[model samples]
Target: MSLSKDKGEQNPLEKALAAYIEALQTKPVLTKAVTSGCISAIGSLVSQLIVPNPANGGKIVWRSVAAYAAFGFVVSGPLIHKFYILLDKMMPPKKEKTALDGIKRVVVDRLVFAPPFLLLFLYVITILEGQGHQAAIARIRESFFPVLKLNLQVWTVFQYVNVNYVPPKYRVLFGNALALIWSVFVASKRRKMALANK
Candidate 1:
């Protein structure tokens, strides 16, 4: 009788446990994570493409598309997601998430965020350049302030657009577009710099 009664009663938590199990099986959390990842990568490549154009002399077009794509997928995508996720968690939007909240985001992002990403980006470019002869640092060192000013302008402007208008949901796509522009400039500059050096 007790055994039958126990079966009839069951447990409320059993339903919850079952629901949780079902949720895991479907893995919506994982899907969301992946979506975030894709967004980040795509966005970054686009942004990277644009900001490097100051180096371009004449040849600036769609030639750097592949590089921008790869950059987006590999470097920019993963890093952007990490930044966005961390920032979201550390300082999640309480209400509607005002733009003024950018102050906190900027503090965590630029100080803790921008430098590392920028360093890694520079490092990657440096390595790629070194592999051939386009070493980014060497080229930049060949002309310091000009490169500095050019980079400052592009990054600052691009970032402002990204932070102000773009919702975090779309930052990745935004970044990709910006990267594409940077790539054009970068490719053009690289070509010109190479030719001039010769």
Candidate 2:
């Protein structure tokens, strides 16, 4: 049993996972921020690869990747970690939480949290890209409602599962995993809009 346990610990994948879990427990906010930043950077890279920008002669924009990563690290991850904690406090789980509890959590998340977050995301990205206040306003005017509509369609379901099923500690990680794809979509949309505006 000792030999087998040692071998299991020696497995690199398992070791890495264990370390990540430890980090999550020991430093939840920082760990989530780093994870979100890395994932966001990768998502930006994937978007660039999938839809090469003609403006930069089809070159990858390193700055944009950095901006996305910064947004994830500074804004998304920490906020989400706290938000999940807040949600749990707002709807403290009983031994037998009803479906209504989950529904209310989802409703609050979708209606209260998402709209301002989306707006902030659009506004921040534009500013990070060196665009002016007017440009950020224009981006919001052009993109907010359409993006919010899609966000409702997609995230309502995701939030239900997240709030109801996922553990609070893992909630940000769960959301960040899905947000990888979301980041790609947002990046592509932002790029398209930038080109359109220019």
Off by over 4 Å in 2: 1-8, 183-198
- Provide the TM-score for each candidate, comma-separated: 0.49, 0.88
17 in model 1: Cα distance from truth in Å?
37
Give candidate 1's root-mean-square deviation (CA, Å).
Answer: 12.8
| Clash counts for all predictions | 34, 0
Poorest 10 consecutive residues by lDDT, candidate 2:
1-10
For candidate 2, list the clashing residue pairs, or say none. Answer: none
Instruction: Specify the highest-TM-score model's number.
Output: 2
Q: Which of the numbered candidates is closest to the native, going by highest lDDT? A: 2
Model 1 has a clash total of 34
Model 1 C-alpha lDDT per residue in residues 52-169, reported as the tens digit of each score: 3445653343434344444545666656856776777887755566766765665565556665566565556445434434566564455545644565566765665565556665
